[model samples]
Structures are given as C-alpha cells and as structure tokens.
Target chain A: MRLGPWKIDVEYGHLALVIVIAGVTGFYLADTLQVSRNINNIILVVPLAMLLLGLCLLVVTQCIRFRKHPVQKRATQLPNHERDELEQEQSPMDLLHAFLLLLGVGALVMSYPLIGLDVATLLFMIFALLLLGVRGWLFVPIYAASFTAVVVGGASRLLPYPLPTLLF
Target chain B: MLDSSAILGAISLLGSDINIWLVIIPGLLIGLIAGSIAGVSNTMAMAICLPLTLYMDFLPAVMFLTAIFTGGGYGGAVTSILMGIPGTTSSVATTFDGYPMARKGLHNEALGLALMSSVLGVLVGYIILLFVVAPLGNWVIRLGPAEMLLVALWGLTMIAALGGKRLSRGLIAGGFGLLLGTVGMNTSGYVRGTMDIPFLLDGIPVVPAMMGMFAASQLFTLVGSQFLIKDKAARRADYRRVLSGFLSVLRYPFFQLRGTLIGVFVGAIPGVGSSVGNLIAYAQAKRTDKDPDSYGKGNPKGVMAAESANSSSEGGSMVTMLALGLPGGGGTAMLLAAFAMHNVTGGPQFINQNMDIVYTIIFGNFIQAALLLVVGLGFLAVAGNIVRVPLTILIPSVLVLALIGSFAVTGDHAGPITLFVFAGLGWLMKRYGYPVAACVVGLLLGRMVESELIRTWQISGGGELAFFLGRPVAMAFAILLVLSLLQPLIMRKFTAWRTRNRSA
Candidate 1:
C-alpha cells in the first residue's frame, strides 16, 4: 500500500484528491451563498450555492469511503486486475459479437421512424434471435404470430399507454 | 369529519362507469405487461399513457393513472426475481435475495412472497394515505419555503450516509450530481450550459437520465456479460406458503401499517420516490429483524419490507402530485404534466377547488389496490413463464417503446432527444457510481426552488437576507436544513468517539 517517500495507502490518494476538491468547492459555495438583502444578490446567494456545497460535501465523504474499501471500487474502478481480467480478456469473437449488437441496436433506432413500432419491433426481435443463436425457419411464424399478439393484444388492447399510430 | 359517502362514491365510481373500468383494467394489464418486460418501467408506462389521459374524464383519467402507478410497481419485481435485473431502480435490492431464491428453485416462493408483499405494502400505503393526507397537508401548509428547501437538502445527505461504507466518495459523487444539475438554465435566468439548445433550456430530464443509468447502462453491462442469467426456480410453492406470508404480515399489521405510513409520508415529500422508500424500508426491516443476515437472502420479512414500502410509495408519491402541485416520483411528474395539459393545477388548493376530481383519485386508488391484489396473484402464479421472454425480444421493443413513451409526453422529436441525452448522462453517472437521484431532485426541484425563493424574496421587498426566515414555516424549514446538514458530521463524530473509547 506504500509508495516511495509517501508512506501512505496508495489506495487513499484518489479518494483524498476527490474529497479535497469537493470539500473546498462546498466551502466556497457556502461562503458565496451568504444571505444577502438584495433580491439579485440573494438569487445568486441561495439555492445554487447551497446545492453545490451540499453535493460537494456529499462527494467528499463518499470518496473518503471509497478510499477505505476495496469492494466499493469494483463498479467504478478504472482498471485494476479484476476489471482488466474481465474486460481485456474478451476474445475477438466476443468483441465482434458486442460490436454487432451495438450496430444492430443503432440500426434499430434509425429504422424506428420509417418502419413504425410493430414492424420495427418484429424485425428487431427476429434479428436479435438469430444473432443470439436461436435457429430455424420455425421462428418465422412463431415470431410473426407472437409479434402480432404482442402488438394487438398487449399493446393495442391491454397497454394503457398507446403505441405510435404507425400509419405507414 | 371524514366524508364516508364520498368514499362510497369512490368505490362505486371504480365499479359503475364502464369506460373507466375499461381504462382501469387495460391500464393495469398494460402496466403488468410492460413492467414484466426488462426495459419498460412505470415511468415509461406513465409517459406513454400521458396522451390517453387527455381523452378521459377527470375521475377515469386519474383512475387509469393510478392503475398504471400501482401495477408498474408490481411489474418491476418480475424481472428482478426471474432475470436478476430490476426493471426499476427501486428493485435493485430485490435482486439480492430474489434472484438467489429463484436460482435455488424457490421461484414460486420468491414470486409469491414478492407479489403478496407488494400488494400488502401498497394496501397499507393507501390506508395510511387515506388518513394522513388531511393532517399532513395541514402540516405542510404550516411549513414555510425554507422548511421545504431544508427537506430537499436533507435528501442529499442520503448520498453521504448511504453511498457506501466510505464517507468522502459519497459526498463527492453527490456534489458532482448537484453540479451537473445546474448545467441547464438556472433560476437566475442565466442559461448555463444550455447555450443554444432550446431543449436544454428546460434543464436535464432526470427521468430519462435515471432510466438510462439504471436500465440502459445495465443493458451495456448485460451485453458485456456472455450469457443471460437464467433461473431454474422451483415449480411449486404451496398455497400454504403464500397464505402464511399473508398471515405473517397480518400478525404484524402494526409493523406493516407503520412501514406503509413512513413510505406514504416519505413519498409525499417533493422529489422523494419509491427508491428512497425501498431503502428506508430495507434499513428499517433490517434494524428490526431478529435475524439481520437473513434479509439479503430470500427472507419473507425482507420481501415484505421492500414490496410494502415500494408499493406504498406510489400512494405517497401521488399524494403530493394530486394534492399539492409538487411531485414525489417520475410517474407523478408526468401526471402533473398531464394535469397541466388538461388545464388542471395540482396542489392542496387544487383539491379544495376541485374536490370532485380529488375525491375520485383518493377513492379510486383504494379500489385499485384491492383489485391489484387479486390481479397480482394471478400474474405471480404464471410470472415464471411470463417473465421468461428473452432480452433479445425485449431490448429493441423497449427502445421503440422508450421512444414512444418520450414522444407521448410531447408529440414531438424534442422529448425523444431529451430522453436520449438523459439516457446517455444517466449511463455515465451510474457507471461511475454517482447518485442520479440527487440530479433528478435538482432538476425537478430546481425551477420550483428558484420560483419559490424568488417569490419569498419578492414578498420580502427584495430584502433577501432574512426574508426566508421571516416566514414562520420558512424559518422552521431553515432550521431543519441546518440540522440536516449537521447530522452527518454529528454521526461521524459520535462513531469516531465510540471507536476511540472501544480502543481505550
């Protein structure tokens, strides 16, 4: 945990920096937000400052907590052994699959306007099913029939929230 | 003092009007359908349905909204128990035990407990809301703007207290959230980062952002994971087990009622929602549980605490939205917007001004709660198969639905863009462990806080220094704010002193 001349838990460095910045910012905001008599002065004084100071203090404390614990860092950690092991170890196949999925989702978003909700959803589902390793022409009718059911029964009949008219 | 006949009319209102019944049943079914799906949330349901409410009468319109409000909550636990994904942010804690229970072949038991727990929770919340709304409204009226602001500020402390075992990181994250919250136009009439974007003029949409962080970000993580987590949950849970859950909750009606009241009261506070309600209930349940470790697992009490608070939060959330112009949750925010579109105002006076509309909502929720209990049981029985729908079918549909939901709020492209921006920002903050709730609080409260502050100042002849304090209610709120700000420090000092004593 030590690093060179600074005999400190290296883990705490990031947390300390984050907290100091937040705490100092909060301290400034609290000062700046002092209640002023003039309406304009008070407008600048209150709310924005108090919120900032409050949030700053919040970040400062949490960062300090982050410094103290290893478990808390997992989801937010930039890259340590665990994150790298999981993320970096992805095979080229996995990379390709992920890229295609992203591309597909992006494409679906684009198609939403032209195709409309029902057609677009059906297309997205069938495409996703194929990519995820589901096989056979059997899905065509099953997909179409279920898609209709979902659109007609679920969306049209049941959903209190109506879908787009999909005039096209 | 209470109007008993009006309550009877409420009961009849839900039953007699055929169109309203049509609206209520469909709204519930749709909410159930959407909620069971991975990405469709209660907010999304409400947003999409915003337009439909435009067509209905006040009573039926509010009924449909209430149906969506309660049904969506029950729907969210579906994905949590079955798929290990919480459809709503509120259900994050559910997965801790629910998913595990499902994996252990206790799916029926888990689903059973969660369903029953949810109904009981909302039922209790409804009952509490029924009694407390009048007295609570009186209390709220007595409070000043300063106190309201203080309550909002108190909410921020939750970040530092609950973020993690660490104190500093929590504050930093909260601070960053508050900073980002100010990115849009401020109360000062100065456009901050909104610069040229007209949509940005309104400030960041926290709902889209929250959904992005909680739902969309999870999709990224899910994409990263090679396989969808599946469950081989047990096929059969005896009716006895389900009945026992009811018996157990009934045995401790006081606890359930108390928890429900807390959820309602908490929910009525502007900017607080079911997520806060859920966590507060979790903490309370854990604190009071004889065996604390059993909570994070598949304990019935754990399920009971979360579901009750979470469901009850709906009633709590609506109380403010319908009774006071302020909103307690995303659904309520959208609801307030609906009221506005229809030329309705929502506040304590709104109820006084429009008792017919208000009474309809108050009584409709009670009837809906009882109905949802029956409907929820049927859904829970088959939710295993119902919730088994793949994310592949789910994601694209949700993407389309999110677009539809956002657009339904405003029949234009701007709403979708707001949804997108919020989604992206939500994903980033959630990834980095920032609190999205604070940002939401800031966004929703930002305008109101600004207006209220300005109003207070104007009333004080621009003498802003002591203007807020001059109002008796505002002064009380100011005191609450100071106390809230000091609480963390006080607790920290106490904890430190205790540790030092232990060491000695």
Candidate 2:
C-alpha cells in the first residue's frame, strides 16, 4: 500500500527499514561480542540477539511478500481506490511540494548549529511561508521576523539556559 | 483496606496547597486547546508544557500535568465533530460518524453528544481508577523481575495490535527502537551503540525524540492543507445547538456506558490506550445497533460510543501509570517524565509511602471532571473558530514553539537537533505506514523493557532457561505472548480456508 501523498510503498519501505536496522544492530552485536562477557553483559546481549533475529525475520518475510505481490499495480493505487487520470498527475506535484517542504526544514535544522538558531529560524520561516504559496512580500518579512523574534527572544528569556545562537 | 487517614490527608493536602489547585485550571485549559487543534496531540501538549512543570513543586507539577491529560482526552472530540480532522488518535473513531453528522448539519448535536460523552467518560475512568489503583498497586508489588519483563513484553505486543494490519512493520520498528534504547552504557558501564559520539553516550533524549515523532511529523503532513476545515459555514459555533446536542447524549446511556467500560479496561493495558478503546467501542456499538449500516453516516450513537470510550481511557491509562509505574501510551510517557522530574517513582512503594498523594490525584480528577463540564462549554464556544486558521501560519508557528520546547527540555542544541532528526524520521515512517505509534511505544518503553529483561536475567542466574518454569505468572505471560504471535497467523489461514470452502 502507498502511504500519504508521496506514494511511498509501505512494504518496501518497511523492508528497507528492517534491513538498515538489522545492519546497525549487527554492528552493535559484534561490538558486544568482542567485549568481555560478565553475567551483566550476558544479560544485555540476550535482548540484542533477540532484536537482531527479529529484524532478520522481518526483512525475509517482507522480501517473500514482495516477490509474491509485485509493486507496480499497488504503487499506482490511490487511497480512495479511484482511477482518475487527472489525480495521477496531480499527486506527483503534491509529492514534489512535500519533498521541498521536508528539504527546506532539514536544511534549516542543519543550519541551527552552523549559522545560529535565531538567524536560521528567521530565514527558514520566510522560505517556508513562501514555499507554502503565501504571497505578498510585505506580509512575509513581517511574519517571519516577528515570529522568529518571539520564538528566539521568548525562549532566551523563559528557557533555563541560553539557546545556541551567534546572533539574534 | 482503605486508609482513612490517607483519604483525609489527601483532602487536607489539596486544601493546604492552593498552588496545586491553581495550576489545574490552566493545565486543563492548555490541554483543551491543544487537544482541540488537530496535529497538536495531547502528547505534544504535555511535552511542550513539561518544561514549565520544572518550575513547580512535585505535587503541583504532576497535578497540573494530569489535569491536562484529563482535559485533552475530551478536547480531541471537539475537532472530530466540528471538522473532519481528528485532533488526536483517540478521536479518530469519532470522525467516522461525527463528521458525517456535521455534514448533515447536525454538527451542533454531534458536538454536544461528543462533549457530554467525553465528560462522563473521564468521570467513569477516574472513578474506576479510584477503586482499582491502590489494590492493583498492592498486587503488582508482588510481581518479580520475570513478571515485570513479561509486562513490558505484553506492552510491546500491544504495539503490534495498535498497528492494525501492519504487524510486521510495527514489530520491526519496535525492535529497532529497543536497539536504539540500548545505545547508551548498560548498568555495568559497557556501551553498545553510541557510535563514539559524546552526546549519544547517555542515549537519545527521549522527550525531544517523542515530540518530534508524534507532534512535528504530524504537523508536516498538515502543512499542505489550506485550513483544518474547508467548509466556512460549518465553522460557526451555535451555543443553543451545542446545548441541545449536550442534552441529546443523555438519551443514549447504553452507548456511553459500553464505551466507558471499553475505554477503561483497554486503556488500563500498557501501550494500548484511548486510540484502540474508541475504535473497539465504536465497532461494538455499530455491530450491536439495530441498523449496523447506519454507522459512519451521521449516527449519534457512534459519536457517543467513540467519545465516551476515548475520554474514559485517560483514567484507565492513569491506573497503569500510578499502580504499575508503566506508561499506558505516549501521553502518559510524558507524565512518567514528570514523575522522573519530581524524583517520584510511581509504584507500590510510592503508593504505600504516599497514599495521600495518590488519593489527591484521583480526587483532583473528580474535581477536574466537574470543572471540565463548565470549562468545556466555554472552550467549545471558541474551539470551532480554530479550524479557520490556515495551516501555513499554524505549522510554522507550532514548529517554532516545538523547537523552543525541545530546547527547554535538554537545555542545549541536542534538543533542537534531536527534534529535527526524529521529525524527519517520524515523517518518513508515517509516510510509509510503519506505525509511528509503535516506534513511540518502543522508544518510550525501550529502557524499561531492557532494564526489566536484565533484572530478570540477573535474578534467574545468568541465562538459565529453566528459571522461566519457576515463575508461574511469567510463564502465563510467556504463553500469552506465544499465542498472541501465532493466533493472528492461524486465524488468517482459517479465514482463507473458510472462504475457499464457502465459494465451493
């Protein structure tokens, strides 16, 4: 089944997820194995082993299911199970919009430590408001600046510690 | 035996501390508003508000938080009835009939029924909590480490059930979470999966991660929507119709009672709270009704059934948190954080030592229930208007608050960074139908599950397989786990066989 507007395959996504999890868990499992094993360490190892095993089963079963039922037909299916030609084209645009939103937000988050919280947030808000199709340059700057100031200023005042930022 | 002194002392405790009582109203108000807004879940509200609790004493902080919990259970129903959007998962079932009712211009009636049912549900849930928690606490005190592990495992199983048909995905996500949970050093100081990062040494900051997964991810999804409710005329709130709708709920006592019962029992189970309760209750009500097909089509009973069960589930969840020290779901996970903040462990020891505090929480809920009826009316009068606010403005605003809230939690860049990372992760998981709730249950309960597993292993003398046989309760749990895993698969096969035979 496709989830959300992005048309991401649920089964394949889950398979990919489990594989990554298994790989990470295997790395950790190897580390614990190398460590000297006491009774306490043995206790910790048991659950990790179980988790590793569970991930393996999840990935394998998902693979079998995927093989039994190929992805093409399911991938194209809309949530309402309707076959509308117009919507088929429309959803991809929606997906692109969603991707841009996520990318913008991600970039802003990464910038927090690099550039600073206040400056990054102000830029992010302006970008986000524009991305969401909020027109009028006058409304954009005022909304972005005021919102960022309220957040940064209010947080600086109320928070138990100072926010990580180079400039207000 | 009930302690008369504890009862009297609890009453006196509230009477003495005006601050404890004062915070409850604001807590309820915040919860009501947060819950009424779709995408601002009770968990997010509690998490965002959690930092504020750091300023207060233990009792007041907890009371305030719990008051929010109580109000939020009902607040979700408002949006469910008024708009098609469910404010919280607890209210998802409500929208089945509630929105349809609103479509028929019975919006006022639907809102009223939802409100009345919610109030009664909260009252019934806490009333059950009042009777069950103390006795349950005593019984749970006798449970050994093995049994505790089983309890944690049972909670994990509930996560799968919460995923509906996405069992494999849920289990895998939960497994990943358990692995992530062990990233930090164990009790023996052996670190497992920190990847050599200093910040990762203590493990993922749970509150920020939870806020990201539950709140921020949900907000991102709503980012495309123009407004919460598309219809302008439906957004108007009529007090007279709301009143009539409120009184109309009294007509369906059976639905309310059934829903409340379902909400309480199911909600009491760790990891399965109001979200499932409302669904099961609504299903039962629909199945048993004279016209089963009438469900999801403006049925008043459906609204009552869903609202009552979901609302009462708050009390049910509280029972688990107070008596067992295990959170029932994400909302209570935040409460558990509050407990940690207060240096208060919720369990039999805490219960026995501080019966007065326990009783105070219950009694305060009773007052909250009464206050909810009054406060909720005022809230409903204004709640409908929020649907008119555009998501473009709402999303950025809430995201900023969430960023600040996370920062407040960790008092470092770690908070905001974690929030951003998990939000992206959560959004991806949601988009793929991986069951973010399962991930949440896993992340929140991961430490407890592993800790209990280690404790059991230690008690059993270093991985002794025979040790399981000695513990009857743990053995019973083990049996339940095996059955829970196998039963679904077996039932699926049987259904296939039956369908094949029927076709033949």
Encode model 2's per-residue lDDT on B1-504: one tens digit a residue. 567999999999889888888988898898898777544567777988999999999888988888888788778877667655466767767877887787566776787778888889888888887778866545545667677567556645644543433566667666666667666777677776677878877888766776677555456666656764557775577788888888888887888899999888767766546755776677668656877556766889989988999988888888778877888788889988999998889866787798889888888888888888888888877765555567787677666666666676677777778877787777767665566655655665566667777788777787688888877878987886666555557656977999999999
Clashes of each: 36, 0
TM-score of candidate 1 against the unseen true structure:
0.67
Top model number, DockQ: 2
- Candidate 1 lDDT tens digits, A1-168: 434433333325345544554464465344334333445434633455565556555554544422233343554565443553354244556445544654555565556567765666566667766765556789754875586456534544544445543642
TM per candidate comes to: 0.67, 0.73
Model number with the top lDDT: 2
Which portions of model 2 show Cα errors greater than 4 Å? Answer: A1-19, A36-39, A42-90, A165-168, B1-24, B30-69, B72-118, B161-165, B215-217, B220-225, B230-361, B380-384, B462-472, B497-504
True contacts kept of 2: 0.47
Q: Which stretches of candidate 1 lie over 4 Å from their true place?
A: A1-168, B3-24, B34-65, B76-111, B129-133, B224-231, B234-255, B269-306, B313-364, B381-383, B386-504
State the C-alpha lDDT per candidate.
0.60, 0.73
